[model samples]
Target: MDLQLKDLKGIGPQMLHILRNNGIWKPYDLLLNIPKSYEDFSITSIEKWHHKETITCLGHITSELKLIRGYKKDRVHFQAKIYNHTIDIIVFGRNYLIKEFKKNDCVLIKGTYDLYKNSIVASTISRQDKQIEIKPHYRIEGIHDLKLTHIMKDLFESQTLPIYENLPKELLDERKLMSRREAFYQLHLPQTFEAIDEAKRRLKYEEAFFMHLNMKKDEKIETRAPKPYDIHQVRALIEKIPYTLTLDQKEAVNDIFRDFKKPFTFERLIQGDVGSGKTMVALLAAYAIVTAKEQVAVMAPTELLARQHYQYFKTYLKDVNIALLTRKTKDKDMMKHMIFSHQYDIVIGTHALIEEDVLFKQLGLVVIDEQHKFGVSTREKLIEKGKHKDVLYLTATPIPRTLAMLTYGYAKISLMKEKPKRREAILTKYITKQTIDDMYSMMHSALIRKEHIFLVVPAITSDKVTDNIETVYQEIIQEFPHAPIFMLHGKLSSDDQDRMMENFITTPGSILLSTTMIEVGIDIPTATLIGIYAAENFGLAQLHQLRGRVGRGNLASFCYLISTKEDVERLDMLVQSDDGFKLAEFDLIERGPGDFIGHLQSGYLDFKYLDILEDEEIFLTAKEDLEKIMNQPDFNSNPKYRYLYKTYTKQT
Candidate 1:
């Protein structure tokens, strides 16, 4: 069972290298490598095949597989007879398997039916007679699902691994759940769709149960008592402001206050779209904590954003002692001393705030802006600087439900749906080569109006960010020669970036061309135009964030998507709605939770079987069961709950 992957037959050096690259080290890992999805490759007759649709058919090779020299690489071209009809077979990247296909050999060919070419673009051609039933599909990049399936076939045929049931037998009987061993195997190789569903249900239950236990893992921590501050002071600061708070903003603030009044630590996420007045809500929350004589640490993802927060706080909370801490802080030691001495009421900075040298005297609240940018452990590290302090996470990117379920499992949630009344929606549109002239004319008018412009390009010459800004700079300069064009990219140093950004901000009618570096917290009120070239290359949340760069000011703004990918689902969703959260939900439905979190979220929720959105009932049941196990002392000895709890702890 613990044998290296090389023990499997037919897995030569190339296959072993591919498997190792994908993190598969041993035969036992095969059982743990659960399939994310299943594709139906059941052999079907050609009569029911649709054009351009994937179809699998049992066929006999009609001609010897011949290797033809392609312009780029050698190609394998063959003909197969299916249902007494001959069809061309084009096999790509599998020329090594040409020896396996003979003129009369029966094979199962699976791929899309190319009606125009009268061929089947072979995604996989299996010579084995065993029909590839509902085939397991791995979400791996280095190898195709069919090849992985074949590898698994060899591993199972060896029959050296002895699987064990992980779940307690009594609980399985009580819940009518499948055995863990059976569930694991069924996930990879199921006989029917119902079997897969049953297997998934069992795995999801265990995953959700463990997740609930992890959610309550912090219950053992000693929490600081809630300190209520006078609302009058906070109200005074709010009153000093020029405009009224929206209803949503008021509700979110009330929610935070309500959490602050609780005996337990307040961990709430104030999720909202860009320009949704979330900063003001966070400001009021910070003010209350400061009034309570507790220090606050506000963390941003980047120095630019940290400086923006520092400036924003200095303007609004003039009386509070606030310090900006970063790598280049003039008096770094002094700031750390002041923070440790409780002289600074509020400290806003980047990762510098979490440095070992930086200590808080009585850190009461941790305010993390753009929470997604930092890893979950990074947030934990910051919060640990003080005793179990209340946490306030601000994210302009809407929380996808899967993330909301996993990361926000135990935290209180407040949604800020409304932007301030003064901010106008940015008019977003997609442009093709034909409509590019109209877009240029529009940019010309915006420049003439004295407004600034932002142009983001996915410029790549050879590699290594070769003139990303310069390549686009040439064309943009030609279009608006009168306006000063500035370039910003990752290659620039911090000082250089600051200088360039300052120049662009101060100089009206100027343009800034760069990458997604300005994706978040770049405030330019006068900048009314943002052009995103190759918009299809970005994710939906990113495009939404880039689009948010505009429409910050009172004036109506425009976002030009310079791509012809109109049929792209994410692009269509972007065009349909200006709501960031809506786009996030759509992305979650399209790409799933893993794509949204990447590898930043690591823990029990580093998910394998979390269909949190679809299995909400299972999660609720797990939560209810968790309360029983936590409260009952007798359950500690009961093998079912006791062993399962042990399993949960072992994972953590």
Candidate 2:
């Protein structure tokens, strides 16, 4: 109500929604959202414009205007020929402008000139009185230009302008940073490119600082009331496991054991790649703590994963009581009784494990599988539940090297480079519709060899994807009518999914057609053939995981990436690179910032336009600024820092 950022006098609900979606709701939000690049249109002569130069022109339009209706609606355009140009000027989507031109005796247009057409098409056209107004245009969203222009125009004329001089002016001098008002003013209404450049530097630095500050704040909060447990007890338990832990895994386990022995709480992220044996490492950490006569809780992303963990724990630690806590268990009383009686030395489940009622008698360690699936608040809740205990987060999504250092700075890392002995490199191939028969022949051969199969669909039952599983299932049934097929998706009941997976796993001749849900925690040794339709549709990390599912078996498993030739070419880049870390980097560089980084990397931070690949130097600089601010709060308390702190705090 008090002239908030998007609350500019003329902005409506629709525009407000757009602004908020783009992380702009307050005046500071607008200020912080700086343009990536500027369009220079200061050239004034027709001769320079006719060089086919794309530049902005500011001038009053001659009274003459032309409205020509062509054969097509799209072709029907407004022609406003400039005073000096012989060629006609075409304005696309300018109905209102055409009507206004007819009614008005005066006009002005600002746009880029095209010499090939010998005309200057308007980027913006307004009356002479409004010609001096500054507008903010973005490549992705055109709405920002209108909203930002009105807001800046009003702010320049209003008394409610933000107090830029609030922060200590000396900090600006020391840091060689711009003033708060100057930064905002330049970003929205830059007189020169230098102003825009300075604004970007200031805003990026601020965003990075707040990110670091929040992390440190969370870390400080997590470390309160240090609790320590016996490390040898957990170690002794891990020592009994059959497989030898990798060096990185062993080191991470030892470091965690050392931290667990401390009186203070330990919260660390276990960074490992897919097939990195993260599960075993986590088991070791949990086993060590559990051996100390303390309870440990493990949470996975999906029911399949939870059940998988439960199966492993139940089988490996048959002597130790392991309780299953998930939504699927039939007997509620059994779950409650086992939990209350302390019959379970370790609890394994999904989100159910984090429920308010699932009490841990002595929650010594909390292990989260696929840590990115849970949001920050949810993870915080889990950490809070394990008061005075250690937190070991496991993620298969490969974290890029630079971001790993910044975001996971507090946590020690472990690598799972080596695959299990006898693990076959799943021969990955891409096929188009033309080669469908050949692909089918290959599947039949695998089946003849007594191998199982997994046919992965990209969508769920209810949630509409580009291509539906029902359609794919129909095609598969039609093509291979003799083979049995099972279906799994998010829409299916947990019981149904579990049953279907079991049936497919046991039934040698059956094929399991499922969403990416079948990617993790489902180990089918005989599943030698895996097929994913529209292969390029999924991210490289996910594609790798799905491929991993089939290759687990000793037999020479194959992943047939079924798609068009074009898609196959796109996917070939990933198919050639088996290194998850390298693939992750390639994926990051290719996709850029429009996609969610954390969602793929299991809780990685996705900064707007701050690509970890291209903007590594800037990322580091932002991180350094944040650390410096945290260490020197008094320095941030200065007036120059006030705008930044206020902007970031308001947004976060």
Candidate 3:
């Protein structure tokens, strides 16, 4: 049999199961499990040993080894005399070591030295001849260190590693990169630090290179027949709005129009901060499609957001036949027939819009709100419902310019950085737990003025509670006994959630306690105050989104970040600025690209080593290399590139 992981000498059935659980089912997988860190086992003099530092000392066990019985177990203790110093050695779990070592026996002891006890807690004791120059430390769980080291050593000495060189020869030569076999060997067992560093660089480049290739494959430019639309009708709809369009909004609308004029199907991303009128841009695009006699579908991630868009569309496009389709729609069959029969010019809904049976009459434009919340496959499924429909992705979570260039490099992008002319800037403040009484007093004043409030928490129930909704809900109701307070969370039934939201919207001076479910979609103009509990627990982008729930109207709005003094430095960034794009850049820098873009979208990229935020140079280099490679005539025909493409596709 081929030497698989199970073929290893000590790997029994239970051991094989544990190895597979850590993604090491094959020998190659085990080889790829590079060391998380390394320990230098070079012998050090006892006089040079530092406290809390792991060191190996060549010494003689001058005193007799004794087994000391403690409350837990027998501990083997001995005193070692080294060059000018006497060091005590203690072994906690190895009583047999007492008989293994005798007085005046020279041995090598490796462990961490303690200053308080003037002793070393021995992790491993070996003959001086077996001392190593450097030891690699792995991150595998539920495995003995010595056993893993022995297995790895055996594999390295006996087995031949799989050699798969994917990079072009010229590029490899120019970059001075090592071949795949050499890189793997050096990564697992390097003679010097330079070798390990070079190996890491090669691996990081491969990660970035493959990621770019996968993204390029997914971003194939399609040549779809253009659908002619009247530009004057779109302009007329824009003019009908009560407020004039900002320059950014006008530019964004013009960009969409330009995209519609192209012969290819448009894939565009429209990003705007809160209250920046992204809905207006979407509405204008819908109007253009409707004017062209083509149907439009706008999908939001949640029902509340879908309803919000439905209301906005109905208010603006009164003559256009628009309908809402959701999981809870009263007449599902009728709604499906109406959508399929072209009874509606525009349809807006949640994921229900992408159902296999929810066919579109003619889906010309597909607008996805909070696009990061949904996976790429979900977006593709909805667009597939239409025949080469132009996709307009709407995101309130502002992305940094660098990130947008790298992640959405293949797509047309438009920005709505400017807010409406009348929208007021929200005042953000960071307060501590002691200041709650004062904040409640202010809330009472706001309530008396007929303004609604939102208390956002991190969790729903008190069991797994950190910034819990139930706890805050009880406190708020007790503080203001006569005030109408309601609780909303993901655990609640859809009907109950909708009722709570409706009640909060219809009732003035109402307080609603909710989780971050209200972070994106639902908007109430009367919601003048937002108190976020454990604000430091939220990302800046999320806090920005929660703050956006208010300040939708001309009313003066306030967002209180309830946190401790320790979190002041981080939360101060939110208090100082309202620009979502700026905050997004900061968030990216502070929390990394995965946390900023969210897991759903980041999982699509699936980069192993390159960080989109920190490894910009590597990413750019890889992109350039990919572009050069794609220009080659044999790029697609090459077996290496094909393999990489196939592997990435399967993983994603």
Model 1 steric clash pairs:
none
The regions of model 1 sitting more than 4 angstroms off are 1-196, 218-220, 375-381, 405-412, 460-467, 564-570, 588-595, 604-608, 611-621, 631-640, 648-652
The CA lDDT at 408 in model 3 is 57
Ranking of candidates on lDDT, top first: 3, 1, 2
Highest-scoring model, lDDT: 3
Could you give candidate 1's per-residue lDDT for residues 498-614 as a string of tens digits? 788888888988888877889889988888988888787677888899999988889989988877566555687788798888888777777777787564454545567766567
TM-score attained by model 2: 0.71
TM-score of each: 0.72, 0.71, 0.75
Every model: Cα RMSD to truth: 7.4, 6.9, 5.5
Which rank order by TM-score, best down to worst? Answer: 3, 1, 2
Residue range 1-652, candidate 2, lDDT tens digits:
4557544676678877877787787866655566655655344555555455454444444445566555653221344434444444456666565557653244455565666666666665555454443345654374746456667757766747664453345445766778767777787777777777786776655555556555654453244433344556555666687666667777777777677656566667777766667777777777766666777888888887888888887776767788777887778677866775677888888888767777766777888887778876677676677556778878777757566655554565665666665577778887876787877887888777767888887775445454468778888898889887888888888788888888877788778888888767777778788888877678787788788787765688788887753765558865686677777776777775336264533233657535566666666666665656646656457655666566545534
**In candidate 3, which residue pairs get closer than 3 Å at backbone N, Cα or C atoms, i.e. clash?**
none
Per-residue lDDT tens digits of candidate 3, residues 47-85? Answer: 777889887888889899989989987789999987757
